[model samples]
Target: MTSLLKQPVVDAINGQVVEEFTASLQYTAIALYFDSETLPQLSGFFHLQAQEEHMHAMKLLNYITEAGGQPIVPATKPVKNHFESVEEAVALALNQELKVTEQINSLVSVAVRENDYLTQQFLQWFVTEQLEEVSSMSDLLNIVRRAGKDLFRIEDWLVQNPHEAAAGGAA
Candidate 1:
């Protein structure tokens, strides 16, 4: 079938796919760091986060394929494997999510420019997802701040508030 997605839109979505995968890899690195530090609970949280990111990428990949566009995989820079603390790691996550949000918005703007209603509609889901991701990451970082060198307290809080913590392993 002829592709409903324009080449530029396909390129943009493929870029998102790369960004999502990069996030997954970064989360994996963070999880490994947490595990090595003997913070199994935190590690598990990041592991779940990594899986979610991978899922996000796969969603985009499938969407592009379904639209009959050729999906391109881009090369990514190395993910940072070392973080001084949980706060640092969570902060990095927030920053990355924010960046991804920006990219998604840009794609929406492009769809608007091209008058591609279907692509614009498709991107709305990503807009909402990014909002949730940003909100969750910020909340987790805030919890870390409140815990303030008492990571175990954060862990306990996550246990008490499993839904809030479950996004990236806050639970």
Candidate 2:
């Protein structure tokens, strides 16, 4: 059998796995912060976000193993749990998703430069995922921004919004 560790594609895959783990931690911290702030709906969204990130990590792990690459244990940093308002949380999410999208794009570029077709193909899913992630976060931010200072209106909007929860579950 070939050693996968020597391959750049394997390194990229490991990096993605680490990124997903970091995302999970970040989302969990966000969820806890929202929960403490008495925003259960927002907390639920972040909880689902955490779950989805965990799933993404597992998917990368499985893909690495299937590709004959040894899975590298990831060291994740603790996520901070402080936000001024609902808009702040949404902005954080948007920023995080954008960062993740850039990371994924970098990985894709690496694969392309290395002429690793398989790795590039695998990254296609991440490209699509980033699109959805950014869009969802943007939508939430827009709604919160439009809701203005009305906490009750924002809470009601969240209560009525269930698509993200369902979509996150599916992801």
Candidate 3:
């Protein structure tokens, strides 16, 4: 199939696929951390996050294929497996979300520069998605910080706020 996306845009999306998969692995690491700590709610939250990130990667891959571009499923970069504190882990997640927001914005810029309306429209979902991702991670970080030594509070918050447990994906 002839590629609908220019080379630059295709390259950018492939890079984003790596980022998304890396995020999934990072979240899985965090979930393992929480599980070891015996915080089921927190662990479950990150497990859900990991699945969402994997889905995000798959979405980009599908978009690339549908656009007639050869989708490259590159290996993800290494992720931090250990974290000192709950706040530290949550902070890391928020930071990752922020970085991904920048990446998605860059993708949009590339589409705009190339005048690829189709690619630009296709990426709008991710553009809007970043807003929710960043916001949810930020909120989780705040809660973790405020809970301080009371880590159970964070778990309780996750329980009380079920939608938040799903990382803003729930209705």
Candidate 4:
């Protein structure tokens, strides 16, 4: 039976699942690093982020199965386990968010080019999600830079700003 999703699109989405899982692993590693550094709040934040990324990967896997395509699970790269500072870790996160945004944009472009309205509509959510991801990371990086080596300031900011703790920052 023919599937609603194109082969290339399914491949792309499967690739995206791997990317999301990779992000999860990266966050987990960062969280572990924060825990080792005695930054409980940051560690917890990244742990939550890792869970969100894992959820996103499962969501994509579901989409593939629902669309009658086989999801290709790929091995992710090893995550960097050390950071010089919270600022550096946050910078790495921002960079990853930017890359994910680029990837989502490319997927949207492909969906449009292929006239795959269903995929296009589905990817719209990701487009907005990416915007929020980028914005939140930018905000975090700015705060990290302002805090300098005072990691407590970041924890304090988190304590004071509960809204910033919103997972994935849905904007």
lDDT top scorer: 3
Q: For model 1, how does the per-residue alpha-carbon lDDT over 1-171 read when each residue is reduced to its tens digit?
A: 899988888888898898899999999999899899887777877888899888888888898899999987678658999899999998998899999999999989888888889989988888888877898888888888999988898777767776765753321
Candidate ordering by TM-score (highest first): 3, 4, 1, 2
lDDT for residue 27 in candidate 2, whole number 0-100? 89
**How far is 139's C-alpha from truth in model 2 (Å)?**
0.5
Question: Across residues 1-171, which tens digit of lDDT does each residue of candidate 4 receive?
Answer: 458899888988988887899999999998999899998888888888888888888888887788888887789967888898888899999999999999888888878888889989888888888777788778878988999888899988877776766747433
Deviation from native of the Cα of residue 52 in model 1, angstroms: 0.8
Kindly list the per-residue Cα lDDT of model 2 for residues 50-141, writing each as its tens digit.
99999998988887888788888799866767878878877988898999999999989888888877778888988998888888888888
Question: TM-score for all predictions?
Answer: 0.93, 0.91, 0.97, 0.94
Residue 28 displacement in candidate 3 (angstroms): 0.2
lDDT of each: 0.85, 0.82, 0.91, 0.84
List, in order, the clash count of every candidate structure: 3, 0, 0, 0
lDDT of candidate 3 over 49-95, digit per residue (tens) = 99999999999999999989999999889999989988889899999
Lowest lDDT 10-residue stretch of candidate 2: 1-10
Candidate 3 ranges beyond 4 A from true positions: none
RMSD (CA, angstroms), candidate 1: 2.3
Backbone clashes in candidate 4 total 0
Query: Model 2: number of clashes?
Result: 0
